[model samples]
Target: MDKSFKIYVVVFLLLILGYLYLESTKKQPINWFPSYAENHKIPYGTYVLRNELKTFLPNVTIDEIKIPPYIYLEDSTRTGTYFFADEAINFGDAEFFRLMEFVKRGNDVFISTHGIQIDTLNFKTKRLVTGNLDEKVFFKFYNKAFKSKEFTFNRAFINQVFTKIDTLNTTVLGITGYVNANNERTNEGVNFVKFNYGKGNFYFHTFPEVFTNYNILNTEYEQHTANILSYVDSTKPFLWDSYYKTGKSGISSPMHYLLSSKYLKWAYYMALIGVLFFVIFEGKRKQRSIPIRTPLKNQTLAFTRTIANMYYEQQDHKNLAEFKISYLLEFIRTKLHIPTTTIDETFYKYVALRSGNTFEDVEKLFKFCDEIHLKNQISMDELIKLNKMIEKFKNTIQYGRK
Candidate 1:
């Protein structure tokens, strides 16, 4: 090989080697998005919680629920806990009502989200967004049994406390909030509560991140998560919700496989880069440039407008009306497919039927045109009237079919 070709090959090889080295050495960043998907292994996902739920309560039969509460509740009737843990579970009107009914029928519904408020049921939530960086949130159970150190989370966790509740039916289960900077024992409000409804109970918890993989896997924080779930009656069936998650369960698309892994994603990108490089370097095979040609413009509408304007400016309404009548006849022949040999009863009948206009309207329009055609000099009013009638008839036409 020549010296220049050898140099080109060497450069290409170096580029490929450099790309491989970069790809091998690159470190993927951590994803901190609060997806709350039971399948995701991200920091805020509940994958660890879902996998270890059986170990936590071996007696409880775990069933994965992929459909919405409304559809599932309507189709089947069962006694179990409908467990939901997500960053947000904003139920629709119908779904929420259906869920309430399900709970009323003596089935427990455990929902853990950022906030909880059912104004109709005399339950409300209060939020606190004070810029307190040092103060931490203290989460502890109100029950004296299983007494342990209060679990604390950093300032990243905000407050969504239960501010109001029905005293007769509601019971505070846990208190979690900044409460007080100097004294964590002070009550800001309760973040966890239990409501005694019809025949069942509603367990509401605001700290959804406790159910996430991060907290559940943390050695120091794992016990806290267990403490929260201690309230669940595990002897019954446990329906683990796969629905109402921010990061939906299974996302399948053409790019799903490649994008799911960094290596495959980068490999696909490298292939695209190679194609682009080939187009830039080797695609120019000494082909001659093809000249660009502009298409001809149709000036039919402009020409018609110019003629109409000239006729109006010269006050030749008689001839202009005649011209319009002639064009109208031609349009009817081509568009309506009726012969212009005579403007008789049969012609009017056919035109009316095809153009979707009443027979009387069609007959009246043709009579007016005929009257204008016979006049030597027509008024501007008569010309305008003729134009209006013609336009109205054309607008009502069902075109494209013969």
Candidate 2:
């Protein structure tokens, strides 16, 4: 590599570092994730709601339940208003059964989420998009005493309301709606409902976004939040759930800061690209040429032909025939695993069966070889005939003829 090219490479790397540093220093935009976590101070987080609960209902003990209900509800003596607020609440079979038993013991459970699998209550919700670009939804209560003016939420990106509820058992608490494309104010769906399970009750609210810092901070919408909390018995203890949330209960990975920040994320991507470019360019620069060499030539067939020519020139038929017979018998013993100790009752049968040749052909070949073995001298044509018979017998084995 040239010194000038090295300087250029160094300058390029410095430029990348400068770009990453500037990006990392830039101001971050607002995060709109529905964390539903009490720790988060973001718009969709429940930090404000979590704090105000202590102030709204003064002197009441509101314990945060970070564990699942199945584990928490093990103590049958513990009874209170179990409050849960999130985008969606998912409960396992064990958790659901425990909650039912807990509620049956004359305790209340208040859940505010868009979706839930509560087959015991037989309820389902529908999420809707507004007709206008600037979205809107009005939260209204069914009770006349709680109803003042309709609480309007102009920043709703989506509205989730109960499309179907067990009407026979459930009593409506509130509703949410929007203006349609026809310029008409149409009721969307049920937002809240109260159902009596056993001695206690289960209050289900579809619009959980209301229980956030954004809604609670607004004077116009704060009343709506207050009215919703009023359903719970203030005198009893409140169990605030923190387990089932879109955001994690704790930061599990150390790479969260690097991955979550926009600038740092870009820097990480550039680092990978730099590594790839380095491999491609440096490999081309330092790569050595692989030399081509000739392979070893096989001399096995040449050596065998030279030996056969020597035997033919000297007219050594008797010695040649002895060598050929010894080699064939050794091959039959080692390769075919058949004995050549004696041409006995079982020799012909075994050879025919193992070599895939007919019994008659195997018997005639061996008998002819035996006669040749007794001869003192044989002619060239007799030697050629013996080689042809051996080849034909081997071909029967190769072709799998029985």
Candidate 3:
């Protein structure tokens, strides 16, 4: 109804609209990574390389191994002789020795592009060495577009070869085609190698991308993957270590993630409620008009007459003389429109000139009035002369005449 209330309503509507706009934008779900497996028609829940192993190691009767996050290596047993490392991390020295023992017992271990911490183990002493490779090499190999971008395969598979060659009783099998730093294809002498450890044979392929579905379909890597799988004996139980299947590592329970999301949602709702409460309670209230009360008009004159009659009835001479001087002073001020408090000589001069009276006469009249009030004494004739002077001063000021 009021102007201020209308402004508040308009502001409230704009705030609601703004909040809705923000919510609308926030409500839209964000898609982080595209569904590459679905789009490319790959089998769900299987890595590109592991999927290839199913066909490649058909003779070995491959058994897919699903390792849970933060697993105890000792608690788990392998039915087949092979272990796969996809992208799993936090595998300590004890686990490494257990794995090496498995290999020593005539088992095959296959590790992918990342999560291969083989350098941490000492083959001669059968102990952990606490060794770490350059992280830059791993990051580049995993993230770099192998098919779209040209990358040298020389350094790519060299680590795999070095791992096998450095180990006890391991031999060089063969190498894949090498490329120069400029991505130009070149023969770097060797691509892959083989190692003989007692009765067990260690085969290492440096180019893990060759086994991926993207590379398997390509003419260059398909033969390499097929050739590698051809070495497997199907009669022996096969273990597809899908432990390192996806690039994701350090996974938490689904319950923990969901609980955190719910807490954040509750905090957001509480903040919205607080803002709404402030707007409703602290906003201005409606204003009302205050009524006016007028005083009785003629009260001043009525009081003056009442006081005058009382003074006459009492007949108190000293008080009557003081009252008469006060009334005459007030009458002169009101009628002449001159301030009673003004003591300036120029004001008296102006009053004398306007009243056709001498300056000495006006001065004497004001002096006598003051003298009567202070002395509290006045003759009847002096009072009559004072009244006549007051009447004459009033008539001159009121009529605007000399």
Candidate 4:
């Protein structure tokens, strides 16, 4: 409607178009963070797996293990398989010992990750060397019961495989295959391994992404995850870990609920807007408006005119001439820096030199000055001529000296 508003709309539209162009041309962010938290719904998050575990095992109670294993050991009755899904399996010396003792007391612990901290357990990972540049990596269970033979992951990633295993107390479950530079397929890389502890077992799998929401949602991998979970002892209750992967253990936060709910978020924005409007309106009312200031009118010209008019009305030409002559003599003394006691040739020469005027002109002006003092009354013609000469002399002099 308005011209300024139309300009604003055009500028806003241009900005939007520019942003869209930049976004199209800009490189998308690489999602390298492995957020395996139960609450996160990202591609690599285990929210679906956590939920599926709850649904599939309804009879078994699944409690969150927030604190360290030592604290968890305080609960004497708490006995179940502690499930952990993360990018890495790092543990403190105390936590490691606690977990070992925990499993020794008939409790099991399942860890699915790409990395493990302890080196004592006999196992070495061998990364597949290949030049085929294949994005999909495949894995299949060693057990023959899985009707669907092998499952292939379409995403671009590397699969960790256990090349060495302690066959004395460990058993290999699944193996990952990789193509070498020679175009030969090798299945020596094992993805799953189970170690027997005191009275329980420690299950470790390299492919943790298979249990994530993105993979588990796929029908092909859903069965794959179920088959893996089959290894867990169903007789014992489940203990879902929500602390290590994420740093928190809870359903959700109060701030999260406030932000997620549309009404609450909108309410917060509206309250902020109301506060801004209040500050603006209140400031306008409280602060005083600056008054427009006009400079005082110059009355020098007006005063000169008024004095001239009064003198004309009174017919005081002689008095005016006398006053003009006196002022001219005083100006020559002060401004020209010359003695004015005698109005002779020497005075005329000094005045002419200081005022940058002709000697003749200075002499003529002083002649009028002498005549004005001698005569009792001055004629209008003479007064006018005297005024002209005085004004001419003033124009020649330096302003600063004046």
Q: Give TM-scores for every candidate, taking all chains together and pairing residue i with residue i.
A: 0.66, 0.62, 0.39, 0.55
For model 3, how does the per-residue alpha-carbon lDDT over 47-83 read when each residue is reduced to its tens digit? 4655566566655666655553123234345434564
Q: Candidate 1, which segments miss by more than 4 Å at Cα?
A: 1-20, 115-117, 179-187, 286-402
Clashing pairs in 4: none
Which parts of model 2 are misplaced by more than 4 Å? 1-11, 128-135, 180-184, 257-402
Residue 31 C-alpha lDDT in model 1: 86
> How far out, in Å, is residue 104 in model 2?
1.4
Question: Model 2, 1-402: lDDT tens per residue?
Answer: 799999998898899879777877788877788889998888899999888887777767789998668668878998889999888788865578889888889898999887788875687767865656544577789888884567887564557777678878789998778765564676567878898878788999877878988889998889888888888887779999988888766666868877976767887888897888888898789989989999889998999999979997999887887787788788789878988999854687677656767668888888878888899998888788878778887887777653
Off by over 4 Å in 4: 1-33, 179-187, 246-402
Count steric clashes of candidate 2.
Answer: 0
Q: What TM-score does candidate 4 get on C-alpha atoms?
A: 0.55
The Cα local distance difference test for each model comes to 0.81, 0.81, 0.51, 0.76
Highest lDDT scorer: 2
Each candidate: how many clashes? Answer: 0, 0, 14, 0
What would the per-residue lDDT of candidate 1 be over residues 1-402, giving only the tens digit for each residue? 699988997898799869877976788788888988988999998899999998777789999998767657874477788999887777755567777888888888899988544776687887755455656677878888857468876528656888788989988888875655576544456888899888888898888988888888788889888887888888778999897888857867868977887778878877887797688667776656989999789999999899879986999988878888899999998987789998898777667656767679899999998898678898889889999988888877744222
146 in model 1: Cα distance from truth in Å? 2.8
Question: Compared with the true structure, what per-residue lDDT tens digits does model 4 show for residues 1-402?
Answer: 589988986796687657555755576564445788887777778878887786666567788777556457655676899988888767755467778787888989998888886455676775654456743467778877886477777776557888777889898888877644564565447889898889988888888888888788898778778888888888898988776784233436888777655567656655775687577658778988889999899999999999999999988889999889889878877877889888787667666655767678788878778778898887889889999888878977755223
